[model samples]
Target chain A: MWRKLLTRNEFYVALVVVGLCLVIGAVNPVFFTVGNLFDLVRNSVVMGIFSLGVLIVIISGGIDISFAAVAAFAMFVTAKILVPFHFQGTILVPFALSALIGTLLGLINAVLISQFRLPTMIVTLGTMSAFRGFMLAFIGAMEITNLPPAMIAFSRSFLVTIKQGRFTYGLHVSILILIVLAVLVWFILNKTMLGRGIYALGGDRSAAERAGFNIRRIQLFIYCFVGFLAGIGGIVHSALVRTARPFDLVGTEMSVIAAVVLGGARITGGKGSVVGTMLGVVLVVIMNTSLILLGVSSFWQRAVLGLLIIIGTGIPAYQATRRRRAA
Target chain B: MKQIAWRAILPKDTNVRWLLVITVLVFVSMSLLRPTMFFTLDNFSSMAFQFPEFGLLAMAIMLTLLSGGIDLSIVGVANLSGILAALVLTRLLPAEASALQVVLYSLLALATSLVTGLTCGLINGLLIAVVGITPILATLGTMELFTGIAIVITKGAAVFGFPELITFMGNGSLWIFPVPFLIFVVAAAVFAIILNKTAFGAKLQLLGTNPVAARFSGLNNTKLLLQTYMLSGFLAALSGIVVLARTNSAKADYGSSYTLQAVLIAVLGGVNPAGGFGRVGGLVLAILTLQFLSSGFSMLRFSNFFKEFIWGAVLLVVMVINYLTNTRRERREALLQAKECEVNAQAD
Candidate 1:
């Protein structure tokens, strides 16, 4: 049992997380403070949700980069819809609207991929640009600073608060949403027939079909679920940041995709876990936030992130090739 | 004999013919719609100067797609190459230098761009071909890496102050043709010949078509991939040089949108994303078609955002059409094979 745990990718990721935390704490003892912990968890919320959705798509033998555009479009449109009505209600309506919009966008991808049999990457690539362009051209390009009162209040709402030296840090309510979604996604991935079907599909598509799985329905469900999650993530981001910029979430695809991949999700598909993905998200978020504390310049931080990705992807690939050669 | 020569020069693919027709249609329509704005020599010359940077990048990306991979890092390479060349020009060349020094320094800067591009490509090649990472993911990593390096070097600032000779390469005209367009023509001609007439190109197509078969048949798959990526890098560097000359500056984020546009162009040129097939003639025609559409849209006063929308819509539409045509071809071939099999059975 111990050996099995040691061999699991999650275990390695968890170990690295702990080691990194310790290193940072040793350098700046402020890292161990609850204030910083809340900050870390808060920062991880948006990225964590995105990674979970991406993990599902990747596990089912497809990649959906259009999620960023979906998120941006969903939140931006939701904001646009709410601002006109002056509807300052609970956040539920906003979340629902954003998720619905995202679902519609995702349905487009699903039909193109599963029905028309287009390549997932190319289809998503086309849609990413199309959706982004559509929003900027036809809709609106300006950032919405005057978010609904509910969203602004939600941004300020915290589950736990820490006060220190004219600074107050709190674990935002959005982290609770992330935790709940993480649990839900975990249950779906681990305890459902749909989960098994997804695995089979990713492992071998023809075999999955032969084993009585509805590949089309599974794909449809997978992308819709991704879009739904992206919608949630988008709204959460806006709630936290207090604005809806059209270009807010598109470029972050690299980091989020990198995080998922680092979590031991094979780019070729069929393997990953919610726990591992969360750890990967934590690692990425920590690197993004803590490099400043490590005294690395912001410009050099991107180079470091790039190097980390190459090394992270490179080592495993190298080992696999070596193993094949030996065989 | 003349027919043979013509066939050799023009690709025999139906897609290439379609592309040619579309190019002509776009050209003719633009000319008819806004004869004063679109059909003028001045407009043509300006467009000729503007498109080569994009065209060169599209061709670079086409090579990768042809070999069943993608170099998402081409834009990064271009910016980095341009940045490095600009740095060299500013740092090494004196402001008070004579024309002789200017020419010599410009040549050195061009070399710098080419060498930087090659190095970036070598990194991509090593990562994808040797380390065995997927091309998209590998290039995605390098894209960030190269761009990050560029940012760090210039501190996210644009580098400027190139020599007169370098600027001339970008803006100068030679005998009624833009220098950049002339460079593009020469490069495109070379690529067309290489694709049609070289063993390396044939091997690359075979490798992309079926890696296992290529390997079993004694082809060096890694070597071919390395060469392909290196060539991609070289082409990107060429574009970078042109960009530096045209813009008179180099920045980390310049033409970031070109990454996707190049990919779209490559696919629009009828290169199969799944690999094993493409033609330079089709690709060149695709570039022209897009350029004409873009120029026409600008002439008609469309916003840049609208043009982007059109590009994406066009890409998706093209993909759907390609899918339909391919399925039809496959169905017809299957029917022919079935008919032959039925005849053979009856005879037997």
Candidate 2:
């Protein structure tokens, strides 16, 4: 059992996350505090929600770089509409509206990819720019500062908050949404026929089609799901920062993709897991926390992140090769 | 029959004809709309000067795409190259410069930029070829790594205020012809010749066409891939140097928007995203169209955001058209093969 667990990519990734936490905690005891952990959880929830979408899309044997854009656009437009009311409706209104708009935008990409049979990476590249451009141009290019009251209120009212003289940290409502969504996506990806179809379609498209899979439908569904998550992720992001700015998430595709890929999700598709991605999100979030703690130059942060991603993927690859050689 | 023969003799990009028509129309309309302004030598010169920075990047992207790879690191490579050149100038050379010192500084900076670009390209080439990582992922990692190095070197500050000679290369006009434009033209010319005239170019296309078959045909697929990425890297570095000159500064994120725009222009120029096909002439025309649009939009007081929207929409539309044409061609070939087989069966 131990040997099997050792062979699993998720096990190693989880081990790394734990190992990194221990190291950081040792270096800076403040990092081990409950408040610090809560902050990491909050941030990781936002990234984790989006990472879930990326995980599914990648496992379906395609890539979507436009999720951040889709998320930002959806969040901005939804916030634009609702910000006028100052977040009056109980949180569901904003979430529902953003998801709808995100789905519509994602549908455009899906239709193009499915109908014309275009490459997803290039298509998403264009759409990412287009969506961001659309938001910057037609949509409110400015940050949605006058956010909804309920949204802000909900974010403040965490499931649990331990306050210690201005040092307050606990799980927020978005954390609840993140957990529910992750579980839901996990169930759908693992237990449903659609999930297996997505896997088969990605593993081998033509073969899947020959064996009675609706390749086009699956592709569209995959992107639509991604768009929906982007919507949720965006709203969660805005509620956390309490503003919707296109620039906030404009170039974040790298970090989100890094987290997902590090979770053992293959870019070429047909491999990934929710638990793995969840751990991956924590690992990335912890790394960010640790960097900020170390007061490392913000510029070196990106370099370090890049190095980590390369090494993260490389070590597993090397191990797989070594194991094959041994056998 | 003559019409079909004409089609056969010409290149596959019929889209170029429509692009040409639109470009000429846009140019003529701009000229009519802003008669004195658009037709002026000054406007033409500035446009010529500005387009090459991303123009070289587009060609770099084209080279990688020809080898069935995509490079997200061009902008990063450019930043690193420019930053290193700036460091070499500001650190090594005396700040108060005579004419001879200016010349010496410029030469040294130019050489520094070239070497840095080549080294970065070699790393990318090695990562994709020897390390066997996907082009997109490999370049993405290096993009971060390179940009990080630039930031470390500059400490996220802008490096600028070079000697007069180097400034002249970026800004000064030689006989009313911009030096940067001249440099770009020469670079574009060399890229055209290398891609269309060289055996290596053919090898790149064959590899993109079918790696296994190319391998069976006894070509060093790996070497060709490496060379393609290296050329791409070199061009990206050249772009960096030009950008450094034009802005009179080198920041780690100088051309953040450039990487996307380069991909847009390459595809707009009809380079196949899946690889195995592209032309420098077509790419140049695409750059011209985009540059004219952007410069024209600015002159008209339109927002820059609209420019990105147009590029994205155009990319999607172009892909749709390309996809349709490719499917139609494949279907025609399949039908022809079917008929030929039927006739052979009768003969048998």
What is candidate 2's lDDT per residue for A143-247, written digit by digit as tens?
767788877886687888788897776777678888899999999899998899888877888888998988999988989989999998998898889887877
Q: What is the per-residue lDDT of model 1 for residues B1-348, given as tens digits with 9 covering 90 to 100?
A: 898987786657877776777789989999999999999999999899989999999998989888889899999999999999998899889879998988888889899999999889999999998999989889988998999999999999989877768888899999999999999999999998888799998998888888899999999989899888989999999999999998889999899889888988888898888888998878888888889989999999987777777887777887887788889999999999999999999999
**What TM value does chain A in model 1 reach?**
0.98
Model 2, B308: alpha-carbon shift in Å? 1.2
Worst 10 residues of 2 chain A by lDDT: A316-325
Structure candidate 1, residue pairs in collision: none
The sequence of per-residue lDDT tens digits that candidate 1 reaches over residues A1-327 is: 999998888998898889989998888887888888888998999989989899999999888888999999999999999998898799899999999998999998888888878888888888888889899988999999999999999999998787889988787888889999999999998999999998888999999999999999999999888889999999999989999998899989879999998888988788999998999899888888988777778888777778878887888889889999999
* Model 2 lDDT per residue over B150-262, tens place: 88888899998877667777898889889888988999999888877889878888888788899899999878887888888899888888888888889998888898889
RMSD of each: 2.2, 2.3
DockQ of 2: 0.64
Best candidate according to lDDT: 1
Stretches of candidate 1 exceeding 4 Å from the true structure: B1-11
Per prediction, the TM-score for chain B is 0.95, 0.92
What TM-score goes with each of the models?
0.96, 0.95
State residue A79's C-alpha deviation in candidate 2, in Å: 1.7
The clash number for model 2 is 3
Query: Docking category for candidate 2?
Result: medium
Interface RMSD of each: 1.0, 1.6
